[model samples]
Target: MKFTTAIATAILASAAMAAPERGLASRVKARAAAARGSRPLEAAQKPADTTNKTNVQYSSNWSGAVLENPPSASATYTAVTGTFTVPEPTGSGSGSSSASAWVGIDGDTYSDAILQTGVDFTVTDGEASFDAWYEWLPDYAYDFSGIDIAAGDEIVAIVESYSSSSGIAIIENKSNGQKVSKKLSAPDSSSHLGGINAEWIVEDFEENGSLVDLVDFGTVTFTGAEAKAANGESVGVSGATVIDIAQGSQVVTDVTIDGDSEVTVRYV
Candidate 1:
């Protein structure tokens, strides 16, 4: 089964109408024009061979830690949460660069759907800007208004899947004591969540049908990272797979998981 084009169109239209303004509309519109949002890892290599080893993979668009295999075969991840300090993105030259850090469920091993939210940091001609947003892929991200974010601000992102077809995405600006959330539903039955994998990712997302230039987002560390399964078990990044961003021949990011509850990604 596939998402009905008519229904998807209506949903997008409704979301656009309800979107916040004050230059936010243009930002959201720019994102909505993208081909896709947060996506599954495009692994460049296979997993490592050592037991209890950190399986390191490389992707063109994503760099972070993913809990792909659940502890229990019957358990499906239903909720994921993480907190990070917004990075100060530095511009390389006279162009725009962007990146986003988010926590999501079911986009790694199970790619049919993803429930996620986070903040996007961008640098244009040496000026920096931040926008908080939520996304349910394959739909584009929508900006969350009324929450002000800046470099050094602490942010907590949470995504919860109530069912295959329903979920919620939340972003809390802990530094400023502001919060925003949205309850979302799958565009169609075929776009339902699989709830198999959970991830804390720093991503170079698509814009205008191409991957945008990733800014030098010095470092982002996801702390208090946790995922809850449908069977009521909670897990961390202890045994998760680590991924780094590799653009062409040179890897651009470094990912490391510290203990079980922390994952850090650094731009190289």
Candidate 2:
């Protein structure tokens, strides 16, 4: 979602009023950069069987697990939730290195839209920062103010869609007992939710129309991962497709699903 000058100015002004301690420009930058939701796997990348028991896929921008509805299936996902400890990002080179962990519905098999919420971890010049935010694709992510998030905080991310055009994104800082939420709607008809996929993902999000440098986010394990179908049946990560991030020919992430309700992503 490209932000116009007016929109950017409005966001900055509100952010300044909401979070005066964090600089206005940095908050706007983080929110704008966080809007790039999960993208389809690059054509060159394909699903492959790993030496382990699970099937693995490769994507340029995403790592974790995605549960997809079969083409012939009647049930659709309406809610997705996951809990994880925020990983402390370590900066390597210059500039800034960043990563985000989020739980969402759609954007895999149904690529038109995504309803997601998570925490972004970044390290710039050896100083680390964390922000909790929510997004509906085709619009810029909005940072959640009034909540203090830190590395090692346990976070619960959730997205629930009541219809194709409406949903809610919620973030709970379990370690601090603070919560924030937003009622989301499709920005346009093209971005409506289809309820085709539910995911727990660590993403190298986009900024200025390009992907930012991925940081070393140690390892993030999403526990209590669950998705509820429109039929009211709940499911976990078992039988979900595993995805690892690959930059060119070099794979940078290792993803594994443990039992039914846990999925882990490790920076490699």
Candidate 3:
């Protein structure tokens, strides 16, 4: 009698296990069916290692957080459509190059500022030109833009050094920021502004505008930095701004930036 009872108990346990298995099969099938008609599994993908071992690329809609090292305190930046300033310095200046998003200048390398300075600008309407100068050029020529610009739009330009009689505009971003700076091949008689006083005059906010017209006129002489380079403090006696009456009547009245802004500085 005990042996029979033990066998019955074992059978009852097996049956219970089989019943759950059948229920689990049903649940699994339901889950499979739901998966086919419902949320698909997203396979995780690793970002492709695109750190440009050979060439750096420029981004029109660049966004990220970064820290810059070197003679850094404050920084100055401007775009032609209007100006936006930031407060980070990577000790950049003139006499270097920019390719893609980096600028090599003044014996220093730099990335773009994080744009914390809160500097803003405005335009009066119609046509406008983009321009600014850092002590050095960008790692490539993808440096400044002007007046009125939209995100994700591209503007290609050259860095020029002008002293009136002799000038040169280095084609900084014409070939993907890989080649050495080249002389702008735009013929002098061909109505293209090239060489040191390189100008890109964007026309027809009244109609068609091209990257060729984003221009910065006149050379930046020197102002704020020389004082800091000597005194170690940002003391100022105010600065001057030159606006084109043709560029829609100058909606912005004052321009300000932190440090390492304004192309060159002259001690008055």
Candidate 4:
């Protein structure tokens, strides 16, 4: 009798397990049928890498942010403007150390030539000086006359490319409201300005043929940066590239972009 009762209980338990399995199978089938009538799910895809896609190749002579047009665009960038503080050179080097901040058209990825204007800061034997200058590179920069610039002056630099070979550069001392504008004519050359890109750069400028010593300029923030295309459209800093000047692993200076128009460069 005991053996018969145990067998019956075991059969009932097995039946209970089979009943839930059957119910679960039915529910799963119902869900599958409903899903089949709905839209098919898409497979997951990985996000794209923006860091590698939107980047500027770094050079030892430059540390700044540069904005370029789309690859297909034959854009003729017309104007670029920004404001920056003259950074004081404080590096522990024996010789003179210098840094320059400027806004200009071309000379990034699309053109080897640059038409730029800004202020240069230099420190030699613990003395610091500031001078306003303009350059159409492959040529020496020319200094503006009759304007006195000192360190800590807030400056507005504007470069307007009016045509393929003509432009104007303006440098203003925001604190004193003193400013100067000069009409520029690019010297005869094969490398005409393509006007493909615009930049806010802090550069280790070259004298003769060598990179000048970079100054410890703390940080120079460029605000209110504006660039316009030939179509009168407001060009922005999207898809722009940030670069840091490095000597092997030792980064000398770095740059950052804020929002779509502001850039800041720092001596690291």
- What is the C-alpha local distance difference test score of candidate 2? 0.84
Clash count list over all predictions:
0, 0, 36, 0
Off by over 4 Å in 2: 1-25, 29-54, 70-73
lDDT of 4 by residue, 1-268 (tens): 3569889999999998865322223323533343111110111222232133246455676677777663336556889999987766675544567777888887767555678898877776666767787777645676777677876888999998878788899999987889998898776665567878788888777653566677888899988887887777776665577766765556666677876778888886
Better of 3 and 4 by TM-score: 4
Candidate 2 — worst ten consecutive residues by lDDT sum?
41-50
lDDT of candidate 3 at residue 137, scale 0 to 100: 20
Off by over 4 Å in 4: 1-56, 70-74
lDDT of 2 by residue, 8-48 (tens): 99999998797533333576665566634445434236434
Which residues of candidate 3, in runs, are more than 4 Å off? 1-158, 161-166, 171-254, 260-268
Write down the lDDT that model 4 would get: 0.71
The top-ranked prediction according to TM-score is 1
Query: What's every prediction's RMSD, in angstroms?
Result: 10.4, 8.1, 25.5, 28.2
Model 3 gets an lDDT of 0.21
- Please give the CA lDDT of all the candidate structures: 0.86, 0.84, 0.21, 0.71
**Mind giving the per-residue lDDT tens digits that candidate 1 earns over 230-262?**
899999899898988877667788889987999
| Per-model TM-score versus the true fold | 0.86, 0.85, 0.20, 0.76
Measured with C-alpha atoms, the lDDT of residue 73 in candidate 1 is 68
How would you encode candidate 3's per-residue C-alpha lDDT over 5-120 as one tens digit per residue?
88999999998886532222332352234311100011122224322222111211111111112123332111111112211111123221111111111111122211110111
